[model samples]
Target: MTIGLDMMGGDFAPLEAVKGLQLYLSEPGAPANIFLLGDEAILRPLLATHMIPEDRIRVVHAPEVIGMHEHPTKALKEKQQSSIAVGFYLLSQGKIDAFISAGNTGAMLVGAHYSLKTIEGVMRPTISTIIPREDGRTGLLLDVGLNADCKPEHLNQFAVLGSLYARHILGIQQPRVGLINIGEEEGKGNILAQASYPLLKENNRIHFIGNVEGRDVLADKADVMVCEGFTGNIILKLAESFYEMTHRHSIRHEYLDRFNFEHYGGTPVLGINKPVIIGHGISRAPAFKNMLKLAAKMVKSDLFDQMQIAFRN
Candidate 1:
């Protein structure tokens, strides 16, 4: 499978991306063919400096770039030759199996929605992040920042999507699904939570295990935490602060270290037609490397196919 990398997306473009390719190539096993999208003038010299093999990588010349502050839809339309736009074009044309970018998040989302489009039978596509549980295990949280306002049906789809992702990419067989709520007992939480609980309980697509309180997020109370983006994003940001706080005070702990976004790479737009990963705008080489690895795993697992089959039934 060929993976597309947006070489001009992040703050330290070309250099960090080239170093990331170097790190990925250093690992054992046959790596996927990579299509590097960026300005040929800048990327060629860096590739040469890094001594990247030409046979394993192909450079696609993309002269423009979408800035972080630019409007998402506008930038994509105006800058057709930009790296992000070029990457999506390649993905939609089947030139690449997956696309990875650490650039403007808005442009990436806009491109995925319009270019690849959402999978059939999906109400709305969602993004998910890996939650590092306290027991030295990992869990998945969905709708972290996408679709802040959602219906019960959206949460139901999120559960199924999150469960499928955990089972396939995370290797968690029969991952337990939980609705994030204020109370563990039935008939609690706001209107959205109350409405979603029944759908999750009744749906056989996921292994629903009732409500999970905020405290359960860090513990292993549930393997897949389902919530609307509003609440989920709050929890995600709060969790991220733990690492920042620790770093400020010079406190070092193994569990807190896992909170680093670099370790897990980037989060994928879970319900898209093709695998599209969005990394942090400030991502370094390690984060970029991990994002490529994650894309490879998702492609190998045929994650979109599994999701389609599950949603169809």
Candidate 2:
């Protein structure tokens, strides 16, 4: 399958993204097609510099680079040649099965939302994050950084998506889902969580685990955790710092390394009609490669099709 990789748009730019590509291409069975978007002039030389196989990679020249600070909606419309926009355009045109970028997240989200669009009946697309659990497995968290303010219906949809993701990628059967709230009590969180609780409980599709607090996440209390973007993003960022701290304190324990985002490659943008994976801003080649690998699996699993069925019912 064709997997589009955005060579630009990250904090480390083309260099790290190239490294990720190399890692993927070096695998025994690399993707059939690797469409790299960004300035071909800058990207081609880098491939040659690393002595990577040029024939395996396709370069699409995207001259305009969207700054991290630029507004997503404005940049997408004005900067037609920007890496994020180009990636989205190619995805929409069916030139690629999936798209991965380590660029400006807001711009990427905005571009992907408008260009590729979301599944019908999907309130909004959430960037789902998965963190390796202490038990040698992983759990799913949604709205990582996509939508801050959400309604009860939005949270309900996220639960469905998160559960399906866990079951497919993480190998969790009948994944137990929960709402990230202030307290474990049924009536704990604000109006949103309180309102969403009943909907999730009523829905027999998922294994509802009532309310799950932030601290209980690593305890394996829930397989799928749902929250608004504001809450989920904060939890994700804080976990990053904590994971780094644990690594520095004792490098001997190999388990601490499992918490890294590089292993998962990147977050998957849910609710989109087509699969679009968003990498970390500072992602490199290995990370990008992993992102594409994840995308390919999503396609093989028919994730979007499954989502259509899940939401349709």
Clashes of each: 0, 7
What lDDT does candidate 2 reach at residue 69?
Answer: 84
- In terms of TM-score, the best-performing candidate is 1
Clashing pairs in 1: none
The TM-score of predicted model 1 comes to 0.97
Candidate 1's residue-wise lDDT over 1-313, tens digit each? 8999999988887799889988987788845889999999999999999999999999999999999889999999999999999999999999999999999999999999999978788999999999988888899998999889999999999999999999999999999999999998889999999999999999999999999999899898899999999999999889988887888999987768878766788889988789999988888899888989999999999578899998775
Tens-digit lDDT track of model 2 for 45-92: 898987778788788899888888888888889999987888888889
Cα lDDT, model 1, residue 178: 94
Query: TM-score for all predictions?
Result: 0.97, 0.95
- Worst lDDT window (10 residues) for model 2? 244-253
Off by over 4 Å in 1: none
Off by over 4 Å in 2: 247-252
TM-score of 2: 0.95
lDDT of 1 at 239: 90
Overlapping backbone residue pairs in candidate 2 total: 7
